[model samples]
Target chain A: MENLLGIAIGAILINNIVLTKFLGLCPFFGVSTRLKNATTMGLAVTFVMTASSILTWLVYEYLLVPLHIQYMRIVVFILVIASFVQLTEMFIKASSPTLHRSLGIYLPLITTNCAILGVTLMNTVVEGYSLIAATVNGVATGVGFILALVLMAGLRERLELADPPQAFQGLPLAFISAALLALAFQGFSGMIL
Target chain B: MKFQEFTKGIIKNNAVFALALGLCPTLAITTSVENALGMSLAFAFVLISSNLIISALKRFIPQEVRIPCFIVIIASLVTAIDLFIHGYSPTLYEHLGIFLPLIVVNCIILGRAEAFASKHSVSDTFLDAAGVSVGFALAIISVSAIRELLGSGTIVIFGHEVVPAFTSSPAVVMLLPPGAFLTIGILLALLKRAKVI
Candidate 1:
């Protein structure tokens, strides 16, 4: 339906989880040093976000609502997200050793990533999206994160050669680049379906 | 020695400026000074309490399950603070939104639990957490102040105009996502240039 498409587009561009929502920023700045690492982190986060969104939505609707402990959402949603991150780590380790190694450093970091948990909570608590809608939002948000990170990676890859002031050499320069990128992305706001 | 541990977190090992560990809340709720203060209070509460409990129970938590345990403690604390703040100030609660609860996943809290609290004694952990919390508070407050002043042309705290508008045409971007990055990015750079970081 058009509604779903709107949600997907809205998440990916208009409300980009990374550039706008300020979620998963740790990896956004940390792992974005290289295209390979950035893409891998993006895919991993996308997987976890989609899986956790579905799971958390179901839990919120089925368990939390029925139990009348909706206030326990923070505690409940985080446990669910942490468990899923663990499962993804284990699965990746077993299925693809290379990816596991490539993503190994970031896997643990993802557990603490506010982006994954932030989206899940947003889907269930804030936006109140249905399961299908929540899943789409999650996937789209992940895609958004990937888009931002990959773009940043490409930019930073070239930034390595550019000579800036002594103070603006490393993260300072990266943050400035992100500012411009975010300003560019800010133009995407307020688009209608 | 204990005083040194607390003092170091302010500058030498600042959670936000040096480590860049607490970027989520630093950017999300820092649109205004009040929001920043509310968030800092909530963050300090969860971090300090979690550090105290985790340090006390670190030995029994078992190495394998310590992370999950730290998470549970921190999440429970966040939920409590979230509810309490909502009841106390519906306005602040609404402004904070999901970022309030997202404190459970803030890397600064978890990173400290793993690196410092789990290793040190309870008192040491408490001082360390307090220091890091203060450092984080200072960083967020400064960023929020900069954003509000430049973006809004004034500084208002708790409904009072503490600082009047200086510019008729403020750089509104300072109040947006880019502003957060710009503020912190330049802050870090200036600190580096002055050897303050």
Candidate 2:
């Protein structure tokens, strides 16, 4: 239990997906313009990430290890993610028209978001997480992504009105802000249980 | 028809500077000159081979299945390159680590396939791939050069320390993840000011 708490806290604060790992940057810049869309996109990614982590964990431990085809994990994980995104898109379109409309644009992009793949890959590659640990990391990473994105969106919403030079108007300003935010997150790196 | 398609990717639509795609690898692995070179060479090989194969077979592949097809081709090439790097240059392979295999999903490769390769002729597609790969390599090298020099107080390339250590205390912040953002952020502003980007 203590180990799990450490993993969760470490993932959420220390190894944040967007701020630290630099994954899912496309949406970090694109969909972060509005709070509504930011929340919707965050929730969408959270669902898919958690679900895919569970499924991929099963495949990795049962199928890949037993088959001795670990090199194929990349190909396998991507296919699973792509298909899962497709299925989720379909389900959203069929089930919740309102939520679907809000999240429609981000759904397809999530296929290439890299954060999803990064989480799954991190499970197998970096952390070497077990099945439960992978699920926890996946969900926690999703939370971390949400935390970063929401904070960015909130700040960007205010930054639009701030006075800035012409050259540093748009994406450049965002990068600077992200740099500061990343630096702030560094303070959490030393946290210990 | 040929040169235009190829040349466009180099300057007008340079993947990193203009398109803003593939920022992850562009920022992450570019902490050192050696990592930058290794990554660029790996990406160049994969981008060229994948684009060529995709263009050659674009006619047979259905539009709906194009993405999966492109991904499979890219993943296979990345795996092959990953294995080759591991066998030949264990040091470079170790330094690159996950980013090496993560190249499979680097949007630049797939973006080129979707945007140019699927529509252009085989020769044209090859040129586009080469141009974009070169452009990406240039961007990574330049960023890594700045970061490595300031962050570490020395310049090292391909496992050889080329420059003497400059300062006892470098700005260690420039070596961390935040430093990547700061470096690129400032570079982008400077480039825009000079109208280079």
* Highest lDDT model number: 1
Checking candidate 1 for backbone clashes, the offending pairs are: none
Cα lDDT tens digits, model 1, A1-193, are 4399999999999999988999989999999999998999899889888998999999999999999999999888988988888888899899999988888888888888899899988898888888899999999999999999999999999999999999998999999999999999999998987
Per-candidate Cα lDDT values, in order, are 0.91, 0.87
lDDT of 1 at B29: 84
Off by over 4 Å in 1: none
Per-residue lDDT of candidate 2, residues B42-156 (tens digit): 9999999999999999899999999999988898898899889999999899888778878877888889899888988899888889999999998888889999999999997
Worst 10 residues of 2 chain B by lDDT: B1-10
User: Which numbered prediction scores highest in TM-score against the true structure?
Assistant: 1
Question: Which segments of model 2 are wrong by more than 4 Å?
Answer: none
Worst 10 residues of 1 chain B by lDDT: B1-10
True contacts kept of each: 0.86, 0.52
